[model samples]
Target: MRVARTHHRCARRSVVVGKPKAEPRASWVDEETFDAKKKRASLILRRLEKQYPDTRTALNYTTPFELLVATVLSAQSTDKMVNIITEKLFQKYRSPEDYLKAKPGELEQDIKASGFFNQKAKSIRGLSQKLVEDFGGEVPGTMEELLTLPGVARKTANVVLGNAFGKNFGIAVDTHVHRLSWRFGFSDHDDPNKVEQDLMKLFSRAKWFKVSHLLIDHGRNVCFARNPNCADCVVNELCPAARVPAVRKRAKPSPSA
Candidate 1:
């Protein structure tokens, strides 16, 4: 899929208008009323939509079960890595029963590159067994049911619900979403669950699914954990963390006449 380029039209709004542009104040964001936060979040989303129109879950999957397994492997590992492993992994195990049939040690080795392979292997097998036994070999659609699967948490559940089932129960607060939430002033807490709640309150339920993808895309491409590319950020003006000045270049001394 072709990812959209960073549109300059979106960047224009990110620049502060006046000389000595005022730095974004986190304290001001802390004091913002619900209405103000909602408005700011709407603007941020609009700009992000323009910047990354192709935002999506980077995990490669053709089925809900495939997505569930891929998401489980994605924990503590990059999506690119997970995709690489799943390319071969999916070709072998196409169903929950297939996973359940595999020997633990063999399955562990299959996804070992994803890191924490033992725990992840246990989760995948355990959840697959549960799916076959309880949910009739299908990944559950509801949050409550999905959470019952071993290793499934709100983050994973939200991901499956929104992306797999087309149900927007809540925003999936993965590492990227968690960081962007704080940077965007949507939440003050570091807890993913609390951050997810704050974001749900700030944006409409209809936007919950796309919100995670947009923030994830922006976080990966621009709002990095260290030294964020604030100048290039599409929502820099609306981002509370964009207060930091961009990296400056020193001019070379004029060559002696």
Candidate 2:
């Protein structure tokens, strides 16, 4: 009887210990085709447009030249901070010629609150000099010409082109746009240029400019970097990462009474 009871307990222990583990569900993005992703991207854009009606650059600017200077100063700084600095800076330096006239150190001191003051000051002075010398003291409207200016990459160029000139060259992949793109499975790339390319392919040219603004607004209000408000996300249903349940550790069994 003791031997029989020992065998019964051993079998029960084996059964409990040998239970099969559950397989992880495939990511929603993994199952989607190119056409499906495109369609989903369109749906996401439509929803986002409804959520944020006003799509505009947060940086305050009156002229294309002011917008260009503000964008240059906006690198590695917040729009609020840039706007604060630009308010006074704009009043002082009205044109590219004015910026060119100011000394780099004086300009650095003027924009010290924007962070990266020295580099920003140099870019401002360098680009201002270029604008005066090459483009007749005017901010160029074309992407090609804009790239020729110092500190004017695709992001800054796109911002100026889209907001100032009402042109859509490409999506401006800022920090907000970058984070949301990966979460939405629009782009797996870490590089901003590649991410912008992916977005351009996923969305139509008409939406190229407004898409960045929508994503930026959403990122700020909902999809935060550290703690995304997935529950209230506008695109939660379409998001692949949204369906994936957050993994939590199982509690250890307490000591038997």
Candidate 3:
């Protein structure tokens, strides 16, 4: 009887341990035709728009220079924290000259709470110097110009261009953008730049700026990094990564209004 009871318990344990609730998927990258991908992507964006109409960067800044600084500080930090740090940083350093003029080690101290203050300080100073000398103290609006700034890359460049300068050279693939891109099967790449390319293929140039914002808003509100509220997602049926069973077929994508 003891042997039988032990066997029964082990059987129960094996059943529970071997099973998972569900797996997230991302298979449409190569499966869908280019036109179908565009249609689905358009549908996804429209639904996201309905829920998050005022899609924009969460960072707080009043000018291009301020926006540039805020985007720089946002690295390895949350927008809320960046905003908190910038609330004071912006008031003190109004232009590239102001950052450059900060006493040695003073800029680091000012942004120490933002974390990685030393490297951030150097990047800020280096970019400030460049902006002052090369660009006449104004943040450059073009992608090529923004890329040349110290501590700036495609992501930061896109943010500055789209939000600050109203240009949509490319999408900004921050962590949220990166996550949602794969979930939506927009890109199979792990690299943000590569992912941005895949995303660029799915939308018109005019929509590039808005796509980044829409994905970011949905990621923050519903598709969390953990325990995402899939059932409540605006495009759950279209998302392979959703924990629930998907409709498993394409629906007629609505035209963009």
The models' CA-based lDDT, in order, is: 0.79, 0.78, 0.78
Clashes of each: 0, 0, 0
Location of the lowest summed lDDT over 10 successive residues in candidate 1: 8-17
Total clashes for model 2: 0
User: Tens digit of lDDT per residue, candidate 1, span 132-218?
Assistant: 999999888999999999999998898888877789999988776777776677776756788889899999899999999898878
Error of 3 at 34 (Å): 2.2
Residues 1-257, model 3: lDDT tens digits? 01110000000000001111144585555587878878989999989989987777787777877777877887777777777788788789878888878999999989988788999899999999999899988888899998999999998899889987789899988777777777777776767788889899999999999998888788777887677788688798878677765344569999999
lDDT tens digits by residue: candidate 2, 144-242: 999999888999999889988889999998888887787788887778889899999999999999999888888788876666787778777787656
Candidate 2 segments whose C-alpha is farther than 4 A from its true place: 1-26, 243-257
In model 1, how large is the Cα lDDT of residue 182? 69
Candidates' TM-scores? 0.84, 0.84, 0.84
Question: The CA-based lDDT of model 3 is what?
Answer: 0.78
